[model samples]
Target: MPQLTQTEMFLAVLVAIFALPYAVWRLGRTDYYAPLVVVQIVGGILLGPGVLGAALPQLHATLFTPDVIAMLNGIAMWAVMLFVFVAGLELDLKAAWRWRGETGTTAALAFTTPMALGALVAGALLLLDARGEWVGAEGQDWQFVAGVGMACAVTALPILVLFLEKLAILRQPLGQRVLRYASLDDLAIWGVLALILLDWERVGRQAAFIALFVPAVWAMRAAMVRLAERDRWYVALVWVALLGLAADWSGLHFMVGAFLAGAVLDGEWFGTERVDRFRDTVLLALMPVFFLSTGLKTQWSAGGWAVAMFALALLVASVGGKLGGVALAGRLLKWPRGEARLIGWLLQTKALILIIFANVLLDKQVITPATFTALLLCAVASTMLTIPFATPALRQLDTHRA
Candidate 1:
C-alpha cells in the first residue's frame, strides 16, 4: 500500500535481478543450452513490456518508474562499459595471426555469408516496412539494411569463452582454435558497427579522436606496464571513463571507446587468472542489471507476430549462413565434416556482444524498437541453440578423432 523511494526501488530491482535468474537457473537446470546469462536475458524480457508491461501496467509502472529507470540505467551503463572493456582486453590478436590462414578463412566466411544473408532479409523487409524510427537518425536505407544484417553475423566472443570453459575445453587445442576464429570476428564486428554509426556532422571530432587516441593509448599502456598489477585495476577504470568520454564526445559512443581502451592493453599484463576472476565477478554482480535495463527497452508495438516472423527469418540467416560459410571453408581447407559442423554451430552462438550491438542500433535510431525486439529474440534463440546441437557434434567429433 506504499510507494517506495528511488533507493528502495533500486534495491528491490537488484534483488529481483539476481534472485530471479539464479532461481530459474538452479531450479530449471538450464545449464546445457540456457546458462544463467540466458535465464537473466529471458527474465529481463519477461520483466519488460512485451509481457509484464502488457499484462500488468500498474505494477510495471510502480516498480520501474522514471527515476528508478534512470538510476538503474546509470548503473547498467557503467557495468556494461566495464564489461565491454574486459571483452576487448581478452582478445588474442597474436594467436589469431599465428593461425592466420585457417582462422582468416573461417572468420571471413563466417562473417560475410551471414552479413549478406541478413542484408537480404533486411532488404526484403524494406519493401513494405512502415516504421520511421527504424532507420538511422541521419542514415539511409542501405545503412539500416547493412546494420541489421551484420547484427546477425555477430558471435558473442565473451559468451563463447564462457561456454567453452563450461564444457571443460578452455585450454584444449580445439577450444583455443575456436577462440582465435571468434577473436577476429570480434574485431570485424566492432569495425562494421563503427561504420554503421558514422555521423558525418561529427567527422572532425571523430578525426581528432583518431589522432589523439593513438598517443593516449601509448601513454596509458606504458603507465599500466609500470604500475603494480593491484594499482592497474584502479587506473584501468579511470582510463575507461576518460576514453569513454572522448569517444562519446566524438559521436562514436562510449562503449566503443571502452572496448578500444582494453583492446590496446596486453592481456598478459593483467594476469589471465585474475582477469578471469574479475570477469566472473562483473558478470555475476553487475551485468544482471545491464540485462534488466536491456529488457526494459524491448518493444513489440509492430505486432508480435511480425516481430517473431522477422526474428525467425534472421535466426535462419544467422544459423544457416554461419554453417554454410564454415562448411565451405572446410571443403576448401579439407577439414573433417564433424569438426567443421561443430565449429560452425559454436560460431553461431550469440549473446552479450550481439545484444550490445543491437542496443547501439536502437540507441542510434538505426533500427526501430520493433526491429530491436526481433533482433533480441534472434540473439537469444541463436545462443540457446548452441550447446544442445553443438554438444552432439562435439561428442561425435571426439569419437571420430579417437
Candidate 2:
C-alpha cells in the first residue's frame, strides 16, 4: 500500500464528507428534522479531535497532520465566506422594512430574549471555571459572556431557509414572515458582534472601512445591476474576496465583509434560481470542509459530562428564550392562537449561523475551545429539535383553524 500524499488525504476527507452525510440522511431517514447538513455536522464532530482523533490518534495524525489541516482550513474559510455571502443576499431587508412594526417587535423579542438567557448561562459557566478555561484569553468578561449569549440568540438563516423548504413553506406567507424576522435579527447579530470585536488600536481602520463601505457598496450594487447574469456570478465572487479583505483589515472579520458584500446587492438582480443553485452547489461542494474544520477544533478538556450539562442548560435557554420571546410578541400583537408556538419552534432552528457566530467568538479568544464544543453541541441539538417539534404544532394550529 502506498502512503497517501497530501492531495490523496484531502480527497479521502472529501469522500468521507460527501458520503457519510448522504449515507446518514438516507439510512436514518432524518430529512424531516436533522436534514443532510445536520448529519454532516455531526459526522464532522465524530471525525474531529475529541472523538475520532482521541480514539485513534495514529490514524488521525496520519490523515490530519498540520499541513493537511491548514489546507483544509483554507477551503473551509472560502466555503463559509460564500455561504455567508449567500445568506446576506437572501436577506429580504426590504420586506422587513415594509412590515416594520411587526417585524421589529418580533425580531427584537426573538433576539434579545435568548441573548439575556444565554448571558445568564454564560455567567453560571464562568462561576464554575476553576482554571479559567472557559473564557477567552484577551476578551473582557462582558464580551465573553455577552458574545456567548448572542450566539444563543442567533438563527441560521441559511439552514432555516433549507428547513422551511423541507416543511413546504419556503414560498408561503408564513415562511416569508419568518424570514423577515430572521433578517432583522441577522443585522443586529452582526452589529453587536462588531461592537464586541472593536479593537481600539485599529479603531481608525474600522471607522475608515465603514466610511468607504458606503460608496463602495453603492458602486458595487450599480455594477451588479448593470452586468449580465453570467458575469455577475464571477464578479460577485471577486467582490466577496475584496470586501472580505477590507473587513479583515478594518479589525472586523472577513465573514462580516462577505455578508456586507452580498447585502448591498439586490437579490432580484441575481435571479432567484441562480441564487438557489449557487447556494446549493456551495453547500454540496465546500461546506463539508467547514464542518470538518470546525470539528477539528472541538476539545473535551472541560470534561464531557460538564460540557454536556452546560450544553443542555444553554439549549433550554436558547429554545425557551426564543419561544418565550416570540410568544410574547404573539400575545402583544394579538396573533391567532397557536401561531406563536409554531413560529417559535421554527425560529429556534440554529446551525450554520450560530456556528459561524461561535467560531468568531473562538477566533477572537472570547470563548475557550471547550466552550466552543459545548456551544456546537447545543447548536446541533437545537437544529434537530426544530422540525419534529414544529410540524405537529403547525398541524394542530391548522386543524384548530379548520
Candidate 3:
C-alpha cells in the first residue's frame, strides 16, 4: 500500500472493531460461553497493546494513530453514557422495594461480601507489590483497595437482562426476582463508585451539582411528561449529555451523571417496549466501539503472568463471595434450595459493569493499568462462567419443581 489517508485508516479501524469479535463469536460458537458483547471485549483486548500490539507492533502503531484513537474514544464515551443511562432507567427499584425483605437482604449480602473479600485481596497485593506496580500514582491505599473491592462486587445489569432473555426467563417470577436483586445492587454499586471518586478539592462544584440536580430533575420530569414520545427520546439524549458534562465538571465522572439522568426519568414514560428497543438498538450499533475502546486501554506492564494470577485470585473472590453471600441470605430468608446458586451465578455476571468500573478507577489514577488488566480479566472470566454455571442450576431447579 502506498499511503493510507486518515479517513481510510479510521474506516479500516471500524472494520476491525466490528469484524474480529464477530468472526470469533460466530465461528467459534462462543455464545454458550461468551456472548457477542463479551467476545467484542475480548477482541478489543486482542486488538489492544498487550496482544496484537505486541505481536504486530508496527501495524498496531500505524493503525491506531492519535487522531484515530481520539475519534474512537469520542464515540466510546457517548456509547457508554447511553448504555449506562439505559441501565439506570431500567432499575426496577419499585419492584425491589416491593420485595424488600428478600431482595434487600440478598442484594446487600451479595455486594458487601465480594467487596470485603476483594478488599482483602487488594490489601494483600499492596503488601506483595514492593515496587507498587498495582496501585495508581495518585491512589491512596484505601482508594485502591476500595476500588478493586467495588469492581469485584459489580453485576452488569444490562448483561443480566440479556442473559435472562436468552434463558427465556426474562418475564418469569424468578427472573423478575433476580432483576430486583440486581437492580438494588446496581444502585449500591454506583453509590460506592461516587464515594470512591469524591474529590475534596472540587467539593464545591460537586455540592452545587448535587443541589441543582434535584430541581433540574424535577423540571426535566415535568418536561418529559408533557413531550411526545418521539420528542422525549430526543430530549433524553440531551439530558444525558448535559448531566454527563456536569458530572465530569464536578469530578464525579460523566458516566455517573449519565446514569442519574436516566434514573430520574421513569422507563414507563417511554413505554417498556420502546425502552427495550432503544437499549437493544444502542447495544447493536454503539456498544461494540465502546468495547474496543475499553480493550485498547489494557496493558500488561506488570507481566502477563502476574496479571493472570491476580485475575484468577480476584475471580475466586468475586465468584466465591457472591455464592457464599447468597447462600447465607438463602438460609436466613428460607429461600428454596438451588435458588441461591442460580441467583449467585447470574448476579456474578460482571463483564460490562466491571469493565466500566475498572476504567473509571484507571481514569482517576486510583489503580494502575496492571490492576485494571487484572480486573478486566477477572470480569471477563466471571461473565463467561455465568451461563455454564447457571444453566445447570436452572435445570436442577426445574427438576426439583417437577
**Candidate of highest lDDT:** 3
Clashes of 1: 1
Q: What are the TM-scores, per candidate, against the unseen true structure? A: 0.98, 0.98, 0.99
Residue-level lDDT of model 2, residues 1-402, one tens digit each, is 989999899888788878988998999898877888999899999999899999999999999988889999999999999999999999999999999999999999999999999999888877876427788787888998888789889999988898888889889998899999999999899888988989898999999999999998888877887899889989999999999999999988888899888888888888999899999999899998999999999999989998898789999999999999999999999999999999999998889988888888888888889889989999999999999998998899889889
C-alpha-based local distance difference test score of model 3: 0.92
Candidate 2, position 24, lDDT = 86
Residue pairs of candidate 3 with colliding backbone atoms: none
Global lDDT for candidate 2? 0.90
User: Highest TM-score among the candidates is held by which one?
Assistant: 3
Task: List the candidates ranked by lDDT, beginning with the highest.
Answer: 3, 2, 1
Candidate 2: regions farther than 4 A off: 129-131
RMSD of each: 1.2, 1.2, 0.9
**Model 2: residue 106 alpha-carbon error in angstroms:** 0.8
Name the regions of candidate 3 deviating beyond 4 angstroms.
none
- Per-residue alpha-carbon lDDT of candidate 3 for residues 52-127, written as tens digits (9 for 90 to 100): 8999999999999999999999999999999999999999999998889889999999999999999999899888
lDDT of 1 by residue, 1-402 (tens): 686888898789889999988998999898987999999999999999779999999888889989989998998899899889999998999999998999999999999999999999888887776646356455589878988889889999888999888778889998998899889999998999888878899999999999999999889988998999989989998999999999989998899989998899988888999889888999998899999999999998888898899899999999999999989988989997598899999998888888898888888788877888888899999999999998899999989988
lDDT values for all models: 0.89, 0.90, 0.92
In candidate 3, where is summed lDDT lowest over 10 consecutive residues? 124-133
Off by over 4 Å in 1: 131-133, 136-138
